[model samples]
Target: MKKEILNCEKARSICIVQTLAKLGHFPNRKSEKEAWFLSPLRSETQASFKVSLKLNRWYDHGAGIGGNVIDLVCLIKQCSIKEALHLLNDESIPFTTEAPVSYPDNSGIEILSVKKLQHPALLDYLKSRGIDYKIASRYCYEVNYTCKGKKYFAIGLQNRSGGYELRNKFYKNGSSPKDISLFKTNQTSLIICEGLFDLLSLLSYSPTLATIHDFLVLNSVAYIKRTTKLLTDYKAIYLYLDRDNAGRKATQYLLTQNPHCKDMSNLYEGFNDLNDWWLFQKQQSG
Candidate 1:
């Protein structure tokens, strides 16, 4: 195909909904402003990926990444930015051979119960993100909660202060006493991450990484300063923060404070975070 070379701004403005429809990925449900579909990225039953008709963007809640036509194509086709632009220019190509297949529980969510990881739905959510159930089960719990009296369940990562970082397809919420989680490896070397999924991605990538190094998962990059005291404990600190403005600032601040700290985020340069990188790798590998 003789692809038209389009710039990013122009490529992003392409009608995403129209493009997906042309690709045979019509949404399973629709509204005046938004549409939902089973993610064309992976095979699943229920729809979690959403397309904003007004904003002209797509967000896959399961994978926690979203963007315009160009970004969606990059993920769907597992291609580079330039390749995504080329594919975007060619509308005749329907990438998917098969058909692609949220929740309302608002403010003041309550934790009803916590149990061992066993929910089929939750497991499927993890699978969609390229995380192994066994690895997740080792550190997380199946937390049943309620919001506006509606019952729900999610994968919960507990912190040292007895709080949980709650995540489901529909929402990402944190329980009381939000704090950093530290996994002691009794080793002087440390691997620091920004979120639960990213930490899990490291373990999924190679369990040996954790075996040889301790891990610190900051609930938020705002808590980056909290690690100052702990920084001196490790001889080598490898940072795996998000590749965003705040994460960049945090990484820069940490690198300055702890001379031993190194930005490992460069390893996943194009990705927003480690889990996103891991998901891309897993998808490409398949």
Candidate 2:
């Protein structure tokens, strides 16, 4: 007896955008030929991911990586290439099975709606951050909610617990049930970062890094210990944390734990963090 897997060609023929929906995802924007989404593998405020309906290609602008359906599954599920093939080959199975959100946090935040990312205010906010709406809308939502007797809205990045990590130009807060964000590739290399901006900045420079490497985004340095347990499984780990005391302490602690860990803060030396360095580069280039 022999096991079977989806041939590369078969997997390539499947509709990329439809697969995204099947995996509890949908595009934020779409046109005749293409659809845009926030990269599903990691949390993002911009729609940096795209799927070509006509060509059946997918790309993530922030990460700068793209491919067909097989590549999409491999990246989203953080599974191996072989695993993606087998998963895609099975039509009877639900796409990328996810457990129900356990103990979600509403925290007095009343969610009004979650919809395709659109709205001038949110788009402008993303632009101010040097992110494109075309990219941010993919994995993020234009979320409207009420809290403290006031109505407000922002870009929402859903957590594993079904709560949202909310952000905007003036407002920033998590709805509840905050947790770490992980981009698992089951790869030998891991890229660790302190917050969302730092992770996005790194991905903008090297899109293939996530595909080739793995990611453990603390979302806060509080999750540093969570990463120590993960490091034992990787062949190499890169730390892209901030240049402050907490970040430094976390980096030092990880270094003592794993010989393969490398601190990449020097890449953004003289700056607050990776995003600041990236923003400065953009200014200089202009």
Candidate 3:
């Protein structure tokens, strides 16, 4: 008998609504672009989870987190990405019989322009964050986009799903298709961070450490459940989350799942986060 092995990327591309249906989660209501469901992650009387067929993603408004099919599976099954893939692979039944849905006409936001990180205002913002100009240029871009008929711009950090997390002095939000930013170095061990700035701070302060291991930035605490599943292959998962309530809770959750997961937040014991610690060190040297 030929064994059927599942491809992780292929499995992730599967329609989320279809997958949810396979797991007995039919949508409570549907439109051309979105399907609403009572959140499968948590028990609630009202439906709060929305699946965007146009984007092939899901966002639980109550949780304030969103991601792709892999993330959805991880959230639903409480299993690692590899384990979810395994379970999905074993199921031989077709998840959906319908034809591919067309891309929706109204995406709500439009990318007006994308260019190199050369804007003075954005450069100054990076300086304020204590991130080096060279480092910022390598991982970020200057993005201009339109939403609700208004134009805006921000320093954009692209995630694995081609979505950008936008940040500026005045505005802080993510563009559609919210997802985690992953830097894969083919290393067995990995270090996970909570934000892009934190990852940059680590790179600036400890370039050697940054290069030696892979990195994953949660971008938001709500992503912790989905992010945990991606860490299964790492031999040592070092968490450098902020010393805040959300961070502490996420770290505890990961530790519970894998007792060997290391908590490196002690390195900045008295500070708010890695960036805060790095800024303090810079001030002290001057």
The most accurate candidate by TM-score is 3
lDDT of 2 at 159: 53
Clashing pairs in 1: 38-101
Candidate 2 structure quality by residue, lDDT tens digits, 1-286: 5557668877789888778888978788889988989766545677878887889998664443457888777545545577788877777777744632222233446677999878888888776666645546644788988653457788887755566767776555556555667767579898988776676677765666757987777766665676667788999899898897768988998999899999999999999888789888878886
- In order, candidate lDDTs are 0.79, 0.73, 0.78
C-alpha RMSD of each candidate structure in angstroms: 12.0, 20.0, 17.0
Residue 268 accuracy (lDDT) in model 1:
91
Best by lDDT: 1
Positional deviation of residue 60's Cα in model 3 after best superposition, in angstroms: 9.8
| lDDT per residue (tens digit) for residues 1-286 in model 1 | 6666789989889888887876678889999899999876554578988999899998775444577888777555545688787777766655665432222222244578999999888999999888888889988999987643456688998877777788876556655555788889589999989898998898899877857998899877756777899999999999999999878988999999999999988889998998999999988898
The TM-score between candidate 3 and the true structure equals 0.63
lDDT (Cα) of model 1? 0.79
Off by over 4 Å in 1: 1-107
**Alpha carbon lDDT at 78, candidate 3:** 41
